[model samples]
Target: MAEAASVTTTLYYYSIFTSPPDRSRTSSSSSVSVRRRNPSSLSWVLRCSTNTSFPWGCDTDSLENASALQKWLSKSGLPPQKMGIERVQVGERGLVALKNIRKGEKLLFVPPSLVISADSEWSCTEVGKVLKRNSVPDWPLLATYLISEASLMESSRWSSYISALPRQPYSLLYWTRSELDKYLVASQIRERAIERINDVAGTYNDLRLRIFSKYPHLFPLEVRLPAMDGNVALVPWADMLNHSCEVETFLDYDKSSQGVFYTTDKPYQPGEQVFISYGKKSNGELLLSYGFVPKEGTNPSDSVELSLSLNKSDKCYFEKSEALRKHGLSVSQQFPLQITGWPMELMAYAYLAVSPPDMRRNFEEMAAAASTRTTSTKDMRYPEVEEQALQFILDSCETSISKYTKFLQGIESLDLDVTSPKQINRISFLKQLAVDLCTSERRILFRTQYGKRPGPGSGRFTDGAEILRRSLRDMRNGELRALKILNGFRKLFK
Candidate 1:
């Protein structure tokens, strides 16, 4: 989503004053005192409040700062329209844009009502408390509350831009209903758990650890938007941009000064409503990272329903051999000889997962690599068939990839492992896995190109054709034999 823009004017506090009243009394007659100052001919009085009770006491300077902030918020102009509100009405109330636009243009200013520095030392708890105390009412969602209630508007320019407030990180603390009895207070712990699982805690812990180790920073400990400046929270006036694909604008910030800026990527004409992409930009790198296939026939104007988290049951792998073959590498393309697990361990998995043809090619290459690695390691007591084992393990890995990727890719195409924890509870995942393996075509790498017109003196395709047919027959027989062996093994285990 796009960020809010920086205002040209900077806020400054002048004087912290005491209200004209029985200053020491806790009666309702007490009032807050404030004074604001600026370099221009605009100097104003700001109000500072006191609780008048022992439970909530107000500081002198805080009152003064609040006063100054109030005056600044009051005098600021309206935002632009490219940043539309999700639920806010579009009458004479909110912001409006002054121009028309195309895709990727700056539509409005979205200032931060709450901004925390990227380098700040505050913890998630501190941030949450701050938001709870200072956040405004009327706007229920934090993202919306901070923007819609911050300021008043007059023209269309005011509607063009809104603000995004800073947020606290909230991790999903998982628990299972079956294991609730183990806790000190079963009902309370069960109520607190956002997700449920049938697996043992040890298993769950291992999965969580594996996920964190692979992608530590990728999962947010706290959910928050990057701020424009300072260690403060986003204000009420900004947060109006809704999700759209053919967006006109985006947010940018200055690292050193913490100032936020909004700029137009395209020209916005008067009266045209502005829009910004609410989801991550679709690029080659992002496509792989997120495992999002463009919904078939989806266009820029299509409505977005993005899933933000990764699915455990979906995994991805890469193909160094095919890529190398395409690039004319004969030695199995050693540099890209990479083994990535589910949740997209590295970038190559992204490229491999989206295209079925690519997936088929890469799986073959993985089989080859497994053979090579096993043969190389065999002198030491590795008794199992290396290639087959590795293929199973690779399939298992695919089952543990991110859920978000699965949602974006439309889960029907994944190669899942029924035994894996991620898919153990998912009937659809198991069903899809069976379908993929059963319906998939066999992979055949052409050692030499064939199926061409015979040369002038060529005989009726005798020796070469016979050899090719025999080789194909042998390959098919081997596959049948392997399937029988696997089926027998399963029956014996059962």
Candidate 2:
């Protein structure tokens, strides 16, 4: 959301992920044997079932473990200078400039020996071989690798790094189903979080059926099911760099240096915290993956999705639906709404939504523009249906805002389901994060419109942007940006 040059974490963005908290393993030099447990003991079957402290990993803010990781990396051939891990205001713990860092400086030359990828040697050779024999993907493979090494404790080379990882990573995947429904009931993010949770489950189920169930000796029942979270390739020192929406830098495999590195896009003074981008993510996306949200109005890239749907009873419903199908669109669609501008595809979809029977000829064109894959003209507009299209979007904006309002206003009265103090603390933390995310999402909707509740013929927007911009937050406190964009929308409407 912090609009700047963009990049992805090629050290690869590992979420605060999974595994069973309670388990015992005793290891020999050649292999680590895990004790078998019932399917009921598996944690991935219900990832966030526990609300209190999980015993799988150490505290996230453990500076002592962080200190040990630095020493281990130094001895393991990591060529690092200028930055060191330190407690920071932004991301709990992050890389801070040990000395003045130049804007274009290449930092953190983490060598291959120190890196963790799919090819990293497993503590148990047989376990690694079994996964590779099946050609398991990087995510699932690495997830299993983490839990395997973690179970070995001091016997595994990665003990310091694992100990530094938060026992409970602040991700939405760690939130229970009811927590999502209760706190985020009004937000579309609730649906996205549910889908992510299901994805982890589906991946686990697939692995269980195809691989784990076959090799109980290599991957005991508890280990296989609990070590199921995917989409991560852990890089020890490199991963210590916390995310900032403002920074445009990311870690990558530098071929010449034979290590992973991220070139700084902005200079840092000595003692200043260094930040890197975690891709261009929305407020909700950051929460879903990283379990943090940037403050409101700071992240320029933050946007809310506006859903537009076709009338079920419309006379042209079948024809419109068919046209949309050909263009890879559904009868209902969602378009992203940024504070600066909405997508051209949204404008086109809105035009399609309000088109009359006489204007049916334009259905395919509207649907085509709405599909991002379509190479055709993107800015086609109909002067006859212009006002109707703007009114339709205005109606959707107001409807979304009301839902956000209901949850935010009544948040204080929300009751907790937990009895213990620790569980209460966990739920309270999750609830506060939901409030931050929903508040940020709602602000974007408010930026677009404040017309009356949407209903048949929605006459509030009959006069168009004249009423629309006036209600789009009064723009008096030097909100010149909002006024500038509204003028563009006004011209588009006319």
- The candidate maximizing TM-score is 2
The number of the candidate with the highest lDDT is 2
The sequence of per-residue lDDT tens digits that candidate 1 reaches over residues 30-58 is: 22111111101011111112321111111
Give the TM-scores of the predictions, in the order they appear.
0.27, 0.80
**Once superposed on the true structure, which residue ranges of model 2 sit more than 4 Å away at CA?**
1-55, 221-232, 416-419, 450-494
Candidate 2 lDDT score at position 411:
85
Predict model 1's lDDT versus the native: 0.26
Q: Where does candidate 1 have its weakest 10-residue lDDT segment?
A: 34-43
lDDT of each: 0.26, 0.66
Question: Per-residue lDDT tens digits of candidate 2, residues 1-494?
Answer: 01101211111112223321122222223122111111111112222224322224456566777888888888878775788878778767777899999999888877778767777987788888888898787656866676667656676788877666665566776677888999998788888888877766667777878887787666642322223333224557766776666887766555554466778999999999887666677887777766777888788778777888998888899999998999888998877776655666777788888899998988988888777776654347687876677778888887888888998998878874468897878778877888898888888888666433122121111123433444333433335777789999999999
Over all chains combined, what TM-score does candidate 2 have?
0.80
Q: Each candidate: RMSD to true structure?
A: 21.6, 12.2
